[model samples]
Target: MLLMGVERFPTTADPHGEPAPGHTDWPRLPFVPGLMSRLDLAYKRVGYEVLSVAEPDRRAVMLHSDAAVHSSTTRIVHALSHGTPAADLSRSPAAAGQEHVHMVPACATLGTGTDVSQWVRIAHQQAQPTLFVIDLCRAGRSARLSELTRVPDGELNAWVIAATSPDRPAYDGRFSEAVAEVLEQIADHGLDTSPSIRFVRWDRVTRAIQNSLEGLGSSQRIHTTRVDVSQELPELPFFPNPRWRPGTRLEKLHDVVPPVRAFVADLGAEHFMDRVDDHFVGRQSQLHWLAAWLDDDRVGGLRVVTGAPGSGKSALLGALVCSGHEAVIDAAPDIRAYLSAQSPEGVCSPNPLLAAIHSRGRDIDAVMTSIALQWRLPSEPERRWSVADLISEAGTLPAVPALVFDALDEAEDPDDLMKSLLIPLAGAVRPDGRSLVRLLVGTRRWPAGPLLTLAGRDGGLLDLDDVPVEEIRSDLRSHMLRRLSSLPQYIPPEQRPIRTALAETVAEALTEETDRMHEWGPFLVARIFGHVLATQPVPDNVDAAVARGRTVPRSLPDVLELDLDRRPDGKDLRAVLAAVAFAKGDGFPTEAVAAVAPEFAPTPNVAAGCSLARATDQDLLQHVRGLLDAGSFYLRTGVETDGSTLYRLFHQGLADYLQAHPYPLDSATRSEAI
Candidate 1:
């Protein structure tokens, strides 16, 4: 085991003008922030003290300690021999306007009183075309015992670099282990004499590895598994002000004045008719504002629409997509007039457009399949990028080609799927120049990390409140009417009164000057419908069902509380809630769930239901009703491969709610309480 150490180069800030000798402010360095933590851990593991040597002299920034002076001196000689200047190396600034600073490679050192034979073995190991790890915590640098193998401490010093930044921290143990393994392999293979290890610059390591992989073939090239070092930073909380201040965003809910009403309606919930008429009933003026923004030819770029869950962000995105799509298609004639003339108005008849959309992933794959069905592309010799293939296989005219990624945060594997895959695909432009692509995404504010990054990088953010309440309300009304008419139970007597009462409630609630009504759309549409439906007089069990249902609870908030309260024994109900709320694929099966909560498995007959089948059936019904109007949990149920019915949650919000308001854990506590 070769030893390694780090000399913390403390930079002295300038008392006058120039920085004091060895002075450095580390965070500003973009790469340094990400690199510092790793190197620090590596040096610490190798058992040595890291010292800052930032002197102007060529030998500045040397690993200094009482032990292993020969190794340290040898490292300096190696640097001098390499003709590498002894100036402090600086990294690019991470944040704008931050000062740049210098950072040296991590310098390793040896400890006192090591076994001579062991030192020689490790030293000879280092002399090979191998990575010498100085585990400062456990051991020091070992001197080579043999005349044939001379390990320069300077060579080891030149190998390591200071960790990135303290702010952008990283973990160690495994990372060290990985590095150690690679080093050990290099020594065992006698790679030093054969290929002659080329210690490339630390920064060029990745490129060197890649080239080597290609040259040596995959089997021979060691794929350096870079640890996910980004995890060290403390996770920033979602909200700055954790206290849920009542009525902050609520005022927009009502704003009966034309401007207010239009903005409220944009939230996509016409079900809250009372609020609509009272605060935002007939505000048509805001549509003109949106129309003007949409019609602007100069604003031809990606745009983002964002808001809280009930804020009508999705509705606005749909409306925008519909508006610009035609214009975009119409503009394509300028790129290729002949192609446009050959294709029908709705047909995707452009090769470039087809290629752009077919770049990657299942979502796009489904979109392509639908296109293939519509275009009636021939099943003969399958065409790749031919014009006929484009016409026949392509679905609709991808005019304006607005790739609207609705509810990005809702997507499974958001980081890898959205950030890495979908987003990059959407940003690509067709080389043929027939159509323009724009990406618009909508998501709730809670998990807005990637979305926020997208906005900052490529688009502008649009708050839902920016849209007029009246327009939103009008759209809501139309949507509600359509939905109500579609539902079999909501016809005639039920529709008329429910519609009337809903309208009145919305108007009254929204018109009140004291009430902030803009944010009420999602809640009113979803929650109110859920409550009313649960309370409805069903033909099967009007009295008995009503009695049981009434006991179950009526409101959205109350219903959630009831479900949580219904847990028989408080065996980590919070865990149960979390497990159910964030099930991997919508929901988990009873058996799968039992794995998450094994204690409940033995008493499945009583705790869940009679049998697994009965429990699953009942759970499905509960899930359906439970998800109907709630903002958080959405129910998904189906039988699994194990012949057991499974259920899952649709949103992360339910898990968040559970974590925030958790119940007591375990059988002992429940028994004691009983």
Candidate 2:
């Protein structure tokens, strides 16, 4: 097969005219050069035939740069082919420009911004590249700040991504920091890894970058478009003759992390999980109320415990989960509980709870499993587990099961969740007229929101405001002392007496100041401790610093910013913090942060005097100790009870702060590594 390739460039200095020594468009073709590098390695790894088109002495207008010497045809075949999709690889140009294509300046400035038709025309001209990926974007006006995080379209299959919406200024090469990051990620790990026929899943790389860009705030959204291929391309692991096998029915649960995390992230803890330094105080009445719901003959009604953070509503719910309310223990000892630990606020469809997998990460597979397995009923996957199916599964069980959802107001769409999950479950009845399941919901009391009517309807209301100011003070004091214990270890043993005395003074001062604020949630108190630990040694004038309220935040968002300010890893820590903050309920994996900036994972922890790149899990944990505690701004979503965890902004305050102030990510900060 004779293959002839032509690229028109103003400069051709390095013999083959590759990333021409001084060519203007050199950097824009990063992937072009990158793939060439992979092709050379592909040859070494798979031993593909390397044919030289050049007749050495004859020169023969041949491609000769280190990476450019090899054939792209072979690289695309092994590194980019998806099954037997038919198309050849080639390039052409049309629609030289469009309105404000700010994504990749290096490419757009040259003559890139083109419509799908132009690309299709070009594809037809080239005989069609087997896997043609046209990286393009047309910036669009981002609406009011209120609708910032909303993606314009939900169904995306095209290859185009909006790196920068129209409102942003045009960049030099159309190459977003996001594109560079993913391309490098793909290169680091070979594009195609088929045991049999080697075919690259090009769509996965684009999709990964698209998803990552959303974390950059609403200004950058992504979409995909078809170029010219007509084959019904198969989904993901894009290899020819894809291999697979089925295992035991239960074995299929391995891939349910995102959904379960979403489910739990939206679900409230049974009550509250207290950090060693944090304590859950008061709300005994609320706990009893939750227990009564489980055992009461009248089933399926909302048992709401409402309060601001730190008010113990969540703790009351948590306690019930751990040790069912005492009222029910004597009457209904066999009752079981299913919990939703995170908020389900922003979801458009309640179907996330109905299916095992949801693209948006709102699946409830884990909860169903618990309910099914606990009752010894057939709990098929979420897709097949309808409301009727649940009732059928529970029909034979002697003990009635209870469902508790916490943090209703925090849900992306509390009103939607209430209508979809709460009311439906509440209304689900048996032949005896009693609802099939007991229900408990905990949320904030909104002054004027959709949940008021639902919150008021016949169910019991446990308000934290009635819990007395003195009880909160006692809880705050207890919390302060526990935080102080962690600080003595940070101080040198020789100076213990002075430091301990000073730290206690500071903690006492903080508690008093905290009691004055609104319910001083566990999170704010934790930061106060973080501040004390950070600026330790009980300065020569400790009494003065304590009295001055040196580090306490005026508001919750301020607390997050302050905590971020105290992070030990400098820029690296700041960048990762921003990502976790934006991740919200859908927490990220350890490697996810690494994808944004290769240097982040490898960056040195100058404060701890070690490189994070080589740090052990314990080292990583130690480095992020500030974020691990209860009420801390970030939470790590890990496999069941395992010390290992991936991070997300657990505190709503952090998410609110980031939405208001997308720092370390605004145009200026983005110029850096993140």
Candidate 3:
């Protein structure tokens, strides 16, 4: 790592009485030292050897008093670009045997002194993987740096993250500060591991920096440029997470579990798990059955859990993984006992008891790769492993490995997944005449074919539709009470009792509504009532709150419609929702929402209405944040592949709702619509 910065410029040099004509006497950046310190600390924490150009010898060469003999910036750029060994400017001596060099230069844009072209020149000479974190004004214009450094048809050696766009000036020291902050966060908290590896990539770092700057309300938009040489550079393991211990089974499992799965599990826990006491409530019978299936070696095969769209299938699967095998088995007594117990802490299972995967938007290769990783089997370079290979490998292990697949219907090719993977794995057996692996699956529906027939023959189908209505209602009530008890701290103490009573009234009203509408399950009823109670104005007394609760729409769609109608910025919020609804994969960043929001203009003449078409990017971002904060129940937030926050509908039902009621204006005709 090469860290360099110029806080201030000297007034005079030997031949040039003044510095270059365009160079400003740049103000002293007080935060430079702190930035360098933070970066050094973070890099060292993740086991990187750091070398700073601020060291005595390099500092003299960087800011030499005699510019007439040799320009300080010229020498610095030459040393960086060519690594002159004779002049003692080579970084290779310090970074000997290192495959990658990370260069962080925080300095002013002093004409040729800190011109991006000078930095781009480094990419041309360095053949090894190089990352340049350029924190300078108009750094976004340095997009060509990656292009200049590109190795055609090979692994990209150069990666660049610029502080701001070409048209905008970076705030003094703010970009560096944001970078330092993101580094510290990644070091301390650690990011979700990639599907194959546990390293932080350049894209992840760039997104983290962007999110950090946005969170701090800085106008600087971070830009990143990189080329994947043979798809290697994109997946290149740039930094080892401080938390990861190389070659550990636990770490391997963590690597295999997709970030989307973790995000969904978290989202499910928030809605279904007891928040007040941090306990998992309800689903005792199902939990007991699952526990028995896992414990019983004789009954080894595939077990399927089927339910309606909003019937808590994902929540149940999430509970299984989050609770772990032992916890779920122990918590099977009843809801009361479950509520009293401590919630499961970490998701990493020591033993290969449960290896789960979520199939949402994932292809067969990804699914197979995850399975291979979890099983600790030798991975092929081409990721050409088959279900037969997985089954064959499972026979080698002493203990029967349980594999869990959730949301199979959402896979890229559901039929292929079923026919090729799940069905074959379901019937797989060992030479000793025992099942090689235990399979657990959760889905809304299954194709009526061999797989379904096998499940039926084995009596492995656990239809949540069979779960009694009263039991579901009981769970819903418990969830509601827990959610209500954990009210925002901002609520006044004097109004606490009233709010508590109001929550109870709302819960009871929602339960009654569910009873009236038998089709509405725990997820649907809870989500609707939760949104209603969260968004509605808090009443002074229980009576008014109860009346408000009674006024909630009976049907889920009607409830969503009413909520949208109630918002003054309904159109803008709808636009955000549409973006989220249509987003592919896990979710999309706020930037994507802002980019597409303009097409959904507000209807004219609506009182106090504002159209997103006229909103600036910053304003759109703020509006999205406001919506997230206010209607958290309606939308879910997840971490994208690039380590940025992503927004999506809370449930598939919401997506269905949005699809049913499409935004009328087409993008081509949007201008006239506005």
lDDT of each: 0.34, 0.40, 0.57
The regions of model 1 sitting more than 4 angstroms off are 1-300, 312-401, 410-436, 446-460, 470-490, 493-498, 506-528, 537-579, 585-587, 594-633, 637-646, 650-655, 658-674
Compare candidates 1 and 2 on lDDT and give the better one.
2
lDDT of 3 by residue, 1-674 (tens): 55565554444334546655433343455666667777778666765566555522332433421231132222112112111111112323233221112222233222223334344445445544455566765565554553454455245544557776644566756777787776666665454333224566666666778888987789888766745525534554456555443543323233334632442333343333334423445676787677556655555698888776667777667666654533222322232223325232223233345677878788988888877776677666777876777788877766777877887887788889888888888888887888877888877664525555678788888877677667765665666556555656316676666655655555566556444444444456556666556655567676776676566555565566566776776666776787677776667776787676566555544465674666575566566656544655566655555544566776775776665554744445433322
Off by over 4 Å in 3: 1-256, 263-280, 325-351, 446-453, 488-518, 535-549, 604-607, 616-622, 625-631, 664-674
Per-residue lDDT of candidate 1, residues 232-305 (tens digit): 21211110111112331222222122211221223322223322221112223433343344444233345555
Model 2 agreement with the true structure over 1-674: per-residue lDDT tens digits = 11111112223355455553223332233333343343444333433344322111112221121122132343221111001000111221123222222122212122222122222222222322322222333332211112222322222111233333433432332334454444444443332222121333445555655754554333445433332243334333222212122222111222234433233332222112323333333344444455555545445555566665545555455445433322222222222222122121111111111122112323343344544543457644444455557666655445445665566666555566566555666566665666666666666776214344555677456666555555654545445444554455534554444444544553445445544454545435444455545454444544554543345544454455455555554444554555565553455544454443223343454665435445454344334433233223355343221111355664554555555544444345533411
Best by TM-score: 3
Quick one: ranking by lDDT, best first? 3, 2, 1
Query: Can you give the TM-score per candidate against the true fold?
Result: 0.33, 0.45, 0.62
Arranged by TM-score with the best first, the candidates are 3, 2, 1
What's model 3's lDDT at 455?
A: 82
Which segments of candidate 2 are over 4 A away from where they belong?
1-275, 278-285, 288-300, 309-316, 323-383, 388-397, 409-413, 445-452, 455-459, 490-535, 539-551, 566-568, 584-586, 594-633, 639-645, 664-674
